[model samples]
Target: MSTTTDTAPITIHIPTPLRAYTDEQATATVEAATVGAALRALVDHYPELDANLYTDDGTLRSFVNIYRGDEDIRHLDGPDTALEAGDELSIVPSIAGG
Candidate 1:
């Protein structure tokens, strides 16, 4: 017998501070083949988050930290990290104060 499974969209958790840009949503689902595509789709859906998440050169902001599961994206392929169905991505922003 042969079996086939349908892939599900990836889930991204928006940080509390950035939730406002996502319609106050805590989580968003996007259909993408890679982390870069997922992030692009997210910003496309919520244009307000573009400036907060990425720079004018289309690179993620230095203060932003993206993780796939518990592994940091930076340790992976950065933005080009491969993604599978049901993967969860968390967007964390660095907080600074003295």
Candidate 2:
């Protein structure tokens, strides 16, 4: 038997702090079924980025903010947020502290 996962090619906007890991590219395109998958694909290609975006246990770091268009993934379904073809994602690092 064979199985397939329908994935879409989505573009993730790279923030300045993480651009070096992405070869200085402003954006990256990855095929994924959800936001989690898309982020995994990114780290797969840029291994160094994984440590910065996720914690030791594989959970996304608290300071890394991800948005699907105008909506925050945290307000949606977190990493399980669904994606469609050509979805635009932005990564905003929480760089400020109280």
Candidate 3:
């Protein structure tokens, strides 16, 4: 059996809009193995972010975009994307149109 190694906490960048739920902090560090875990940590720590980040069905909100570094998580493995020790997750909210 293979063993899992504990890694350094990852940095999550909180956008201006969502900073309120994070106690006005622009960034947060969390120990997680995947993007989903990182996001869940945030939601768990700050329950207020739940409504904004997820839908009633517990899915990520359509207007909220998550990116690992410069790559969008949706193009990767969505929430299952693996994260590195120093990986940075950016949460971006989409703007609607015209």
Clashes of each: 0, 0, 0
- Give the CA lDDT, 0 to 100, for residue 4 in model 1: 30
The full ranking of all candidates by lDDT, starting with the best, is: 2, 3, 1
Deviating ranges (above 4 Å) for candidate 3: 1-7
Clashes of 2: 0
Q: lDDT of model 3 at residue 75?
A: 100
Of the two candidates 2 and 3, the one with more favorable lDDT, higher being better, is: 2
lDDT of 3 by residue, 1-98 (tens): 22244445899999897888899999999998889999999899989999999999999989999999999999999998888789999998888988
**How much lDDT does each candidate structure score?**
0.87, 0.91, 0.90
Q: What TM-score number comes out for model 2?
A: 0.91
RMSD (Å) per prediction: 3.9, 2.8, 1.9
In the range 1-98, model 1's lDDT, one tens digit per residue, is 22233334999999988898988999999987778888999999999999999899988888899999998999999887888889999998788989
- Ranking of all predicted structures according to TM-score, beginning with the best and ending with the worst: 2, 3, 1
The Cα RMSD of model 2 versus the native structure comes to: 2.8
Candidate 1, position 20, lDDT: 84
Q: Which stretches of candidate 2 lie over 4 Å from their true place?
A: 1-4
Q: Which one wins on TM-score?
A: 2
Q: What lDDT score is found at residue 37 in candidate 1?
A: 85
